[model samples]
Target: MPFVQEALDGIEFARGDPNSTWGSVRAAMGHPEPFTLKYVAIGNEDCWKPHYRENYLKFYAAIRKAYPDIKMISNCDGSNAQLDHPADMYDFHIYQNANTVFSMANTFDRTSRVGPKAFVSEYAVTGDDAGRGSLLAALAEAAFLIGLEKNSDIVEMASYAPLFVNTNDRRWNPDAIVFDSSQAYGTPSYWMQHFFSDSNGATLLKSTLQANSSNSLEASAILFQNPMDKGNYMRIKVVNFGSSPVDLKIVIDGFDRKLLDSSGSKTVLSSTNVKDENSFANPEKVVAQVSPVKSLVEKTGTNMDLVLLPHSLTCFDVLMKSDITQITADDDSHVSSM
Candidate 1:
């Protein structure tokens, strides 16, 4: 396999085309065998060029004849397309503010039919450099991702684009993850990626949250069924963004358990000064801490007033006592602090 250019040159029909030659050379240097690439796009923003459509069709037809499994994707302006023209994927970009990002979760909620999956390949908080690449943006990104996770059955894949930019030599508006020479640091948006990636559970369980008000307190409960145990357990994630502490009284119904143990933990990402951020100089500026939560005695359920710091993420795991009969009620069951 020559590169993309050579592969295109090897095609007797595409010998004289420069763009075809480029694609051929791309394939050759990367792979020896006929590349099993599934998707290929023609032009990017330049799809509207005068010769681009014809060139795209030529490559598409050639690739289709050569490998039917490969799918051709083309960037086209406007909503309408030739019904007979073939395309396997459609790309859509979004760069709205926080309000719009919050509303987008329900944008396709009424979508009736499923066809080609949508790729939100590029998205970010636009406008206001003050909040553009700040930690608040990361919190918004996390909220947006919660929507994506809810709609993953429809969305095939999504990527945050304009991913990196040198602060001194920025060509675009702003990159989601940015760093300068000698130091690589993640923005608030970057933390959203880590939070989602690190906290993804084995399964997306059907759970619900009970909140007094959307602004003050919000809590989510996810039931994780243990493979070894016939009974299931619960993991509660509570976020208190308010200035005051919230007293969370949780009662889980429809489960039998002899041992019910619950521990609360808090991860504070806030600072005494609202504008503080973790940099290479002081890496541990914002971190999570494990504090002892008050236990409920003489009761079957758990109750505690969780002092969640303002603008913080807290995770709590509850393990049901497997063999309640083995221990005496007077016996002190050691609760592991998170």
Candidate 2:
């Protein structure tokens, strides 16, 4: 209660202060405008604190009265339990093994549809499976992201934690990007994020897989628009967690052979072993490799070969020449060429 105003002052900027204000702090330091302040989290991983709820409400009320437009995040998993105080969003963090995190891809599939949207701010496959940024951990995280993309209505925000780890420090290892005093390089987790980044603001398509294939294969399709040429594309991301390759055949309902171009790309993140990680000396050992895929489609929505490697995260970006006015699939629109 004693730290309410100060916390609000630091979070949303105190309303009645001139000498000690966020705007003035930015200007006095020689910035054109203040930093864009919209979201604020009460605390991180403070769900078990007895005074968390008490302190949270005090801060919430003060900030709400001053800045009614800002969204507040609560440090609790509303999916597992109910919240006493209201929040704009709820914080859900997970640090599990590769198999555990991969299976949690559908964690939000059955969550409550009402109340605040979720903010998966901290999540990663840690411990033995995530030893120094392994390919297995990246594939598991990619599967989880596909589930998030599918359930974007309930899950508003998501990100992997421990983005950087200095080799000398060596405390929070197996990060997305690793660095030392002089050199820095990305792990497989970093490359996996690049695939998901392209899907931002892109329209998620209505696509599904066979029931039997649900165990080891996680996939999602999106109508991604290229920002460069303003062209449309169909992106299919698949994560195969099994030990064997998946001879996958993509069937998009809607036959538009003329809509596709002669170009396509396949970005894969895999390694000889699922436990392979990148070290400072051998940084590129477990990174993703992008290679041009053969144009297997001729006209419209036809079956495309999306062979996924064993224990890999694969992204297939196919360029489309026209915008999709209708995404409905007719009898003739079935693309099963396998």
Candidate 3:
């Protein structure tokens, strides 16, 4: 394979182009080291079109023959109707209101587990409910992401859309990061991603909540290593979608009280108003505010009760101080003197 450094060279990648681009990888890199190319998607949102399958077959045949290890994604969705061609995965794009997207976290729960895995290439909260990536939008999207994290087995990958918007040029609104002139600011949608940036290969936990407001809440727990010290810690993330504050009892089914940190910091994304957006005059109007949770005196040993604000996203990063019980799942008696 040859490395393609330009569009003309890439154009040769078509199925039968005389100067095919697939054969340039070796020459471009000056070596035969395999490129870590695992996934490639066809045209987006072109499903159900007559020419889609036709165009897809050409690339599919050429790529499959040239690189048999590469996994191909079809533009058509076989989640509902089976496509005539073979594909390793399907592209599923979605755009809806904040409230609707909140419920969309469970979108793939009913999909048949036997078919191609789902690749949510594009999704975001738009329309009147989302004014240039407002807090309401981020809260809903955070919940939806939690659902994706829970069902990651079938959901191969997912991503947010409108990643950038140039204030100088009026084009797409509700972007994750907005920039213009000499300054750049991240929307709530952008800050919300920080909470999940380290979950890529981290170990996910089975954390459960028992409260009357549980239905309006979405959460996922994971044990990720700290980059500075490489120490493992339990990070619990939650998104509250209701109007009233929730008194959540943070219960870990597999963690011991002795290993828990003396106290942790809570990062929350909320504002005086749900529809608040960042402006040049007030860039920090809507951002993830970090505050120490050292005053957590309301708990029953390993069971700690934290109050969750309504329409907000929160994460508690508790450090692992020392070795504790290695039991898999049990509510250990809280040792106050840890």
Best by TM-score: 2
How do the candidates rank by TM-score, highest first?
2, 3, 1
Candidate 3, superposed: residue stretches over 4 Å from native: 1-36, 78-84, 295-298, 322-338
Q: Candidate 2, clashing residue pairs?
A: 255-300, 255-301, 256-299, 256-300, 256-301, 257-299, 257-300
Cα lDDT of model 1 by residue, 159-195, tens digit: 7767887867867654655578777666555554543
- The sequence of per-residue lDDT tens digits that candidate 3 reaches over residues 144-235 is 98877766767777788979889888577688988887999998889998888766665566667876698789988766677776766667
Candidates 1 and 2, the one with greater lDDT = 2
Q: Give lDDT tens digits, candidate 2, residues 123-215.
A: 899998888888889999999988888778778888889888877787885788888788998988888898887666666666656433558
For candidate 2, the C-alpha RMSD (Å) to the true structure equals 4.6
* C-alpha root-mean-square deviation, candidate 1: 9.5
How high is the CA lDDT of each candidate model? 0.49, 0.78, 0.75
Q: Give the lDDT of residue 234 in candidate 3.
A: 68
By lDDT, the best candidate is 2
Sort all candidates by lDDT, best to worst.
2, 3, 1
Q: Quote each prediction's TM-score.
A: 0.61, 0.89, 0.83
